[model samples]
Target: MSHVSVSADQAGQRVDNFLLARFRGLPRSRVYRLLRRGEVRVNGGRIGPEHRLQAGDRVRLPPVDLPPPRPPQQAPTRQLDELGACILYEDERLLVLDKPAGLACHGGSGIRYGAIEALRQLRPNQPFLELVHRLDRDTSGCLLIAKRRSTLRALHEQLRTGAVKKRYLALLTGQFAGRRQRVDAPLARYERGGERLVRVDAAGKPAATVFHARERYPQATLVEAELLSGRTHQIRVHAAHLGCPLAGDAKYGDPQAEARLGDIGLRRLFLHAAELEIAPLDGVGARHFSAPLPSALESVLIRLRQQTLTPSPP
Candidate 1:
């Protein structure tokens, strides 16, 4: 028999999901088999797979044969140093970094190493580092890391209650008129050809975004997109629905728009996470963080202004 106690970071997760994470190599069906056979119990009583765990709860499991855990792989020193160079802020409980474009937040699905993996390698002694939220692999900006389970729980609550403000900068394919526009639409996620895709649908979860025009050029417009609700691909899908898809977004953007900016060096999705603000949950003042756009993205704008025949909008 084995016993475990749920900590703050482990709270609110389903029993089966928690077990799956705890025993990394365990198959999903095997986890449920344990639950069905009463081989797993919480507080000395049988619990269903969907039971939500709470902090400090005790979990008991029956002994079963399992394979030995794999040895940890050491991340390349160069990758670790590169990630360290992007650090924007760090403290006892948080680690914030200016994540570069084309780097996944965490490793899986054939990727050898990602931001979190490299960070782990850099701080091999630190035990509790975990991502507070996630960003797309191609999106660059202020990524948050929580060093303490309590801090992670607090930040997760902030995200749930709309107390966290996330702002992103994007270049739309064509002129986006008006000062700002709110896209109040629902979105649904579906898998096609092993790729995840999100689309606006009435039956899906509620998703909203507010787009504010920051600057306008003849061919494309630079806009600030404020997410009212964070759904999968919310900004990208909403932008496409408005007919102003993000430049270089091959998944949701127009191909012609991408070609139009190809000469200007628009090689990836023209989206950047510019800022993050979280209202203090424990009587402290709000915390704000910002990341500057990468040089490559900035060069695209410079080239656009110089080559495009149309002048900047007044």
Candidate 2:
């Protein structure tokens, strides 16, 4: 039997997930089997896989077969250089980066390495680093990394209580009628044809989004979106529900609109994480950060301006 005590860095995570991380080569099914068989115990009692671990809790594990350890994949030098350049800010307790689009926050599902992996390689001396939250792979913007366990916990609390504010910029097809609009809809995740998708459903979790029109083009409109309740694909689904799906959003977007926008240089999902605001975990005053739109997206806007004469609503 092996005994381990959960630390602040490991707290607040599901027991099963913790086990999977600890035993890298263990299959997920085998992990669940251990839980089902009561081979894994917490504080002298068997607990379900979904149980959230607490700091200093004792976990007991029974001996099990181990798989051959796979060699860690190293991040390429070019990728490391690119990630290093994307750094927006760094401090003792925080590391913020202007994450580029097409980069996943973490690696999995056949993806060899993502932003986190690259960072781990770039700063191997940093012993503790973890993602505070996740953005879609194609959503570029300010991403937060906590340098300390306490800082991570503090930020997670802020997220739970709705203290952290995240705003995004996106280009949507069709002209919006109002300067500002709000959508209150419930969102649910479902798998369709082996792909995950979110939709507005009455039985789903409550979600809300507020959108402010920023610019108007003949074929598309740029808008700023504030998330009231963070749900999977909340902004995208809400925007689509409003008859203004995100331009180039291959999943929930309009195909014809994307094709038209592609002719003007909108090649990727037209969503960017524009701003983030939150109080420091160290009880300091709030800090605000913003990431400007990438040049590719800007070029698309410039093209629209030159080709379309539509005037925006003042």
Candidate 3:
């Protein structure tokens, strides 16, 4: 049995991550099991895995196996270097990155390591580095990382209250009705064929997104999506509700359209986190960030433009 007072530096961390970090070799499954069984307590009360610790909170840990520390995992040299080069902006308090597609924000779920793990390896001495928000694995663009616990807490508050503005660019199919449109539908999640998916439902949490058409192609329309409420797969699900599923979206996309895109150099989801805006914090003014579309997606656009302009075979 052991009791530890959460320090200011340790505050705001979820119990699961705290346990994983504290016990070097502890398997994540074991950590959750302990939490589920009420073996871990906060100030004499059981807490869930997602419970954030606060300064001065007393946490009790039950007797558990603590294995010898495993060797520190070293990420691939290429991953480390790629993360370093993708930095759009960095300060003592935060890091803004133009994260490429196919890279997850955190490591897990068949991915041995992701951007967060690689960054930690690259800056081994940096005491605190945590993801402020998550972008889907196949979604590319501005992903935020906090350098301090205080920053992480503040940013999380901003996100929860919808103060931070996040916008994404995606290519949608079908005839978009107007130059601007808003999808105000709640979404619910379910599993099908062992894959998680979301659909609009009346009994789900409230969600909304406003989209502006950037341009239109022969078979698709490029649009910018402004998220009013952050929900799992909100934009993609909402776009589908509008009958304009995202191009190259395997889950809710048109198979024929996706097949056409697969021929035009669009190998991944045609989505990007194009912009982000954070309000003033701790006396600092608001900050904004933008990332240009990747060259691969851009190349597809070029080909689409040429196809649109060229004389069609009669």
Count of steric clashes across candidates, in order? 0, 0, 0
Q: Write the per-residue lDDT of candidate 1 for residues 119-197, one digit (tens) a residue.
A: 8888889998889899999899989998887788788778888988999999998767788999999999988899999
lDDT tens digits by residue: candidate 3, 59-170: 8888887987545566889778888999999989998989989888877667777789888898889998999989989999999999988898899999989999999999
- Model 2 lDDT per residue over 1-314, tens place: 99999997688878998899888879899999999999999999999998889999999989987899867778889888989999998999999999999999988788887888889899999998889998999999999998887798789889889999999999989767679999999999999999999999999999999999988887678899998888998999999999999998989999999889888878899899989998766967899999999999999998988886765662
Mark the 10 consecutive residues where model 3 has the least summed lDDT: 305-314
lDDT score of residue 294 within candidate 2: 98
Give the range of the ten consecutive residues with the poorest summed lDDT in model 1.
305-314
Q: CA lDDT, every prediction?
A: 0.87, 0.90, 0.89
Model 1: how far residue 10 lies from native, Å: 4.3
Ranking by lDDT: 2, 3, 1
- Model 1 alpha-carbon drift over 4 Å, by segment: 1-3, 7-17, 27-41, 44-51, 60-68, 281-283, 308-314
Those runs of model 2 whose alpha carbons end farther than 4 Å from true positions after fitting are 8-13, 25-38
Q: Please say which candidate is ahead in lDDT: 1 or 3.
A: 3
Task: Highest TM-score: give the candidate number.
Answer: 2
Cα displacement (Å) at residue 240, model 3: 1.4
